[model samples]
Target: MSGTTRSGIPLADVYTAADVTAEPAPPGTAPYTRGISPGGYNDRMWVMGQYGGFGSAAETNARFKRLLDQGQTGFSVALDLPTQLGLDSDDPRALGEVGRVGVPIDSLADFETLFDGIPLSQVKQIRTTANSIGPLWVALVTAFAEKRGTDPNDIAIFIQNDVLKEYVARGTQIFPPEAGLRMAADVVEHTAAHLPNWTPMALSSYHIRESGADAAQEVSMTLSNTVAYLDEVVRRGVDIDQFADKLFMFLSAGMDLLEEVAKFRAARTAWSRLLESRYHAGADARALQIFSYTAGSSLTAQSPHTNIVRVTIEALAAVLGGVQTLNTSSYDEALGTPTLESVTLALRTQQVLAEETSLAKVADPLGGSYVVESLTGQILARVEADMDVIAEHGGALRCIESGWFAERLSQQAYEDQQNVESGARRVLGVNCFIDDSTIEVPAFSVDPSAEEQQRKRIAQTRADRDQSEVDVALDEVRRAARHGENCIGSITAAVRVYATVGEIYGVLREVHGPYTAHTGLG
Candidate 1:
């Protein structure tokens, strides 16, 4: 009997060498189907990263220190919606939202408080999930480093500067599509020349998957978005090799165990081929690095404890698929912001998977399995076809601007919701296994006074800073944005002079204009 994968690819019951038409490469070879590193985890284990940020900067700093002390190798930041939208905590547009979902960072002072006693130089990687305001985060980090007498070049920063994905999936976009692309590419060009150790752009399929794209759509759309970014940067006079190696991709580990693994393996293979054949990227550039977070959408509010098991399984899939970095969603994430106990449990999940399991000893442990290999090949082919469709629509940027991509994802999201409602897709606690148990998961809540405190701080900062110098710096940034010049340096200068995130973004907002999603397409 034949079956179908979650991505709607046909699957065979059994397979032989006949199923594998292409030459099988080793773990470290180009078009890395097996794995990227020759030694794999034997040389170094994947970074155990935890995604966190909430309330005030001091509170988030304490959480970061606790996670680091508990053996988290890397840390990821989640900025509040107000910060992500380039509004100050005190802005009328930001009422009731400051420090609610994530940390509220209004100025360099907030960044300082966020990092506090943590030595950023020792952190393996600092991943910030900021899209439209990504350059501001970069500037804050650079200024913070300089204040502490640390060279920004020594820090390994990964910014989710994939603004195109923001337009299609996440709705935190600020500027219009064309201008957003320019800002995203500007970060790549600036970081290539300045921060040598930083990975400027993390092409995120995670949010796309969470927004309801299937495995195939997630991988294909991400790669197509990467193509848009690569073209933009190359047009700015940067070599393919210069910035390609610094690029990274983020995928989502969902409930389909084998299919999730296959999706990742196929992504590595597809990325390698695309870079080599199209961009002429060298070996280092072709060896794509992936970071994955277990799917937040997969967690169920009903029987929230079951989410722990779901996260473990997804994290295992990421490890088996050879992810370079992994973050497991907390069990209580479906309820609200993760409580301290829940986040600790999430970190322990990674620790146990890395320390107690023998799965990491070998690279691509399931590389030769009949089912896995067959699925991998099928996903690669399907993703390529999806890419062709995207190209036919005049590429990723055009599709995004015209709302084609948004319409497709919205339809898929509607269908998935319908499936769950009709009992076509079985979610254990949500749809199938009815339970009378009370929901007892402890969820984190932000202090109501956090907004007031942030407002007072920003007001004090404005009173203390040299108003003349701040005006000059803001003007330089405005000039750079208006004149089509690289704005990273000017933005950094503004950040150093105590300019607020809202101030810098306000300048750009004036230049590029705001973006509102077109609702007519859906």
Candidate 2:
């Protein structure tokens, strides 16, 4: 019944050994066309993470505990928009937004409050959804260790420390690209030197897809950005093997069923080749690709209840695609942040697949399928072609600097919006099956006064802390930035002295200036 993508490439009806351009290697081998790790689910189940953040630190902590109690295997913390943009909670530009989208974190106190009773030592993994607040992560971990009476190096943290993408695409950037990248390098160097096992970078393809790139484009752009980071670190005279092993991948699985599955397979193949051929990385680093949560952008506002079915399909795709970690978006994501009920349902979605579905019993069940193998081959070719185009233009960062990549993405976004508006693309409940009287799903609501309370917290933190210590810390941060020393160490110490996020980022801006993305289409 199925044909091909809208681009009119023929869909291979079935796949065989002859159909795949390269013969499928055994799982855990070079290329990883089958899978990356051996004894896939038997050795480890995909990290099942739940994304939620809202209200006060105490309130969000309660929510975090509740999810963990509900069978969530790991935690993925979400920060408010102000936090994401590196602004203090009380900044005027942050008006009407505190805790509206995610949790409010203004100071180290807030971090402690949010993690009050959570056992950092015993938790499987904790992903801090961060970009601009890379320094905050270091401070938070240090504080957590001091409180637990353990070495901070024992903790695991995967920060979304991909700042260049934030500058060009997400608009969550606070410092200039050069400076922001320097801060990221600090995190990479610090984590590699200290934390050792913790992953410092999760080169995010989630935002790329959210911004309107297709699945193949998403994989290509992410790898291109991965190359950009490797270039930055190699120029710093660090060994790629040491740092690249700690770099992981973050991708999105939307509603495109087969395409999404093939995307993951293609990503594994491309990442291995990129690491081995381009970076001269060995098997240890080439075999490691830490995959994480799929974003909620694919959810539809109309007939929102149908999103459950959609999420289930995406979860299955991620698993069959051989992801090491996976997060299923809440069904009611479009209207608001997930309610506790919605979050539990999302976690249960993964639990059910693990316990009930036969999918977990076998590794790469689709590995030998004629159609799946053929699709994976084509996707790998397309990704390579796209990477070639990026290289011709001088890599991903250069493309972002020249505004070529963003312009292509912007055009794709424009076309997608038009497609939905004109019915050329059908979003199940949104554009295709509409009914005026269809039942409305209840949307999650946040307290309107939450922003005011968050501001009060920010003010209290500043007043209660030693002002001179903050000044000294902030000065040191700027000095580190100027000297090309590891800025994360300085920023980390500064935050412990109650330096507001804005204050630390302001120091970076002072030294390195702010990045201004090219607003005009080229």
Candidate 3:
């Protein structure tokens, strides 16, 4: 209470109504500060989506079934590094990382195995982190649906396809910035023409926050990046109204209770104003839908049980902030994959908040609070100021391509760590509460044999398919990429022929070339 917010917004003691800049408008109105939905959870509860996936296809399939049985309403796939990078299980580079942190998926055959018994129509949403290979990921899902005699339009899907964020905050980028933007737009264009229920983009601020962005900076970068995508998509002659309303955002729910809540409120305020004023967006597009995963960066390995308390606070802020979908991080995730027990505990946390607290009865539980309102206004102002700086530096894409965004994020990260080391910031088990005590926390481990099984599966897929059909499909994909045609159609064709993810990406690599590191543009 004595210090400023993580983003340097000043904190005051005993806020009064005098501190609030504007009086309240009703929820679901213009400049939507109170909440997006008029009735909020009183009408429909937010979807509880706990993120989990690990090891081989069959192993992860069992985990998905278990999660669905435990009352999870959606899917949040965490792809392994190799899969995230578009590498196959048999690739030499994928040897050590085949199935370490998340699920390994090489082709449609793997998806067939991964969702063997799960019904696609029954799931509310299926979201994954597929930035660089977003177009491929969407095609694979559509192909899998066709294989099972399900219409792709009936199954709601979401892909985290913010490729610009990959260049700055995450390291899985496989294309140049300009080329990546084009690929992301290709998904939007193809989705608009084909799968109407699918959301091809989930603009991400979660990674930016984890990479050391504060609340205000997180809001600024996210909106700035949104502009880049909107410009590209609309440039393709696609009407903004048709697909803009379906766009999703992924943000962080941090540990700071009041500021985190204020951040979400501010994000909603800024986004609504931008869409209405800039793009002439309608009511549906202005009501922003947010998906938050509790700050994974906040979890401490020292006293891992303390993470339960951390996630609870973060998830509470997300609910108060009025998210459409939410996932709570498991306590043991920092140490290893979460055990089933830990995952259930995480899900039950949301159940208690939704069912027992009676917090869902009101639209905006903290709507008119003097402190919340004041903090929300202040955070929005800071976000706008930061956006001005981003514009002055030639916008988000320029900042990322020139390494300006990376430089700023690294600077903030360095300062934050310095504060913790110097005791300016006190973390519960990390800096304070010093003891010689050791904590034992249970975790889930990957089986060593999973890698070999994955390799054999990939080999069998290759041996079983017609090489001539795959060759023709790959050639068509290269043609689409070269001729500036939307590549989703051809990519889906390739996946149907059992062309591996790496093979599809390999074709693009030849056409677009690999990415080279950027030095700051001075």
Candidate 4:
């Protein structure tokens, strides 16, 4: 049999032990390339996280219960762009966007509405796509703790707080990269001290891939950002072990199953080595490097039903890749956010894998394969080369500031699109197979008046809350920002005083200034 590389490099007929890196240590030990857990899924299966979004808080909460009832182990919450960017639903820029893509959150009141019946203490873990609104995210968590009658120390949160990538790729950033990094570090330090069970910042490569990065580029960029965060936190005098263990990873599992598995394995190995060499973090800090995977940007829009088959394959790759958590994307995501049915199908995909397939019964089943081991080594070597480039460009922050990162990804994306359009890349049912007769596609519709209703809600929230209290909270937060105090505490104080998400963000906007995309650097 013959094999090929992801970038079309020809694979040799065989590989020896020397071809692969020397086994640094045993599985579940330091430098965990073999695997993070020796028992693997035999001990505990990966946390099966499903992404759910809907137009209304009531609708989203109902679907969340339905998914949990169907055996989902973790919950991933998707907020609308305005909410994620810390805009009140009533803002003019937010007019046409509220609840169009994800759930609309206007205030602490809307947050309360979203998780009304669900008890936070009983849930395993919760993930959010929050970046620019990092302070608001902290506030919301604090409010949840108050309502649930549990200490903020007990609740678990995995916020996608990678602000540099948000500005450079996703277009959801509200502040400059410097201020954003400061907020992420604040979350890291705060969660380490208060919420030991929580994962505060999830350095996300999933969106970088969605922004059109290839496997090697995605791995390199994400790991570089991770190292940047580590450097910042250590420079701020936070101990490496104190916050490194709290740093989780959010990655993507694309159509390349073997490459995906190899990527995860290599990522953990590289991360472990980086920590050991750079910071001298202990085994416990390096061993439990939590990773979560989402379905990638490879799936299509035409034959939407085929995306189920696509997502199942991607989920399997994540499982085999030893992900600690996984989020299966909806089949109908291309058109818009997922409907309840599509979301449930996504959740059930993981359930079937967890319960029916013996896939979870073994760990690192591909650990000894000649092809997989060889590919893992190749991927790591490429990632290291990419890292050298990032370092030469003065790290990820400088790369983004220089626009080199975006230019490279844009070229890759254009090539990928060209490949698909020219039939060089065959996406089944899209560029090939051309089956118009056998398709029974589901009709997806976002709530027609969701934007209007969201605006009214935001207006009513502004009218209802005491303006004097809001002023006091914002002033205190601004003072904290100037003094270089932990912004998490200031955010919590503001939210306790009933400050809206928009108001809290407005304070940061005044202090930190918004990010402007660089055009000339490319």
For model 3, the superposed segments whose C-alpha errors exceed 4 Å read 520-522
RMSD to true structure for each model, in Å? 1.2, 1.8, 1.2, 1.9
lDDT of 3 by residue, 164-220 (tens): 899989899998888998999999888888887888898899999999899988989
Tens digit of per-residue lDDT, candidate 2, span 1-522: 356663334666554577767567887887887777766687778888887788878888998888888777778888889888888887888888889878988878898899889876667778877886776677777765776688877766777788877755688887766677767777887777777878788889888888878778888988888877778778888888887877778888766667777778878888889898988998878875656565577688877888899899888888888888788888888888888888898899999999998888787878777677777888888999999998999887778878887888889889989988899877887788786667677777888888888888888998999999999989898888889787777877887788888888778778888778776654
Error of 4 at 166 (Å): 1.0
TM-score against truth, every candidate = 0.98, 0.96, 0.98, 0.95
Best lDDT goes to which candidate? Answer: 1
Q: Candidates' lDDT values, in order?
A: 0.90, 0.80, 0.89, 0.79
lDDT-best of 2 and 3: 3
State the lDDT of candidate 1 residue by residue for 125-227, as single tens digits. Answer: 8998889988898899899999999999888788988999999898999999989999999899998887868999999999999887999889999999999
Which lDDT value does model 2 have at 304? 83
Better of 3 and 4 by lDDT: 3
Clashing pairs in 2: 14-370, 14-371, 15-370, 15-371
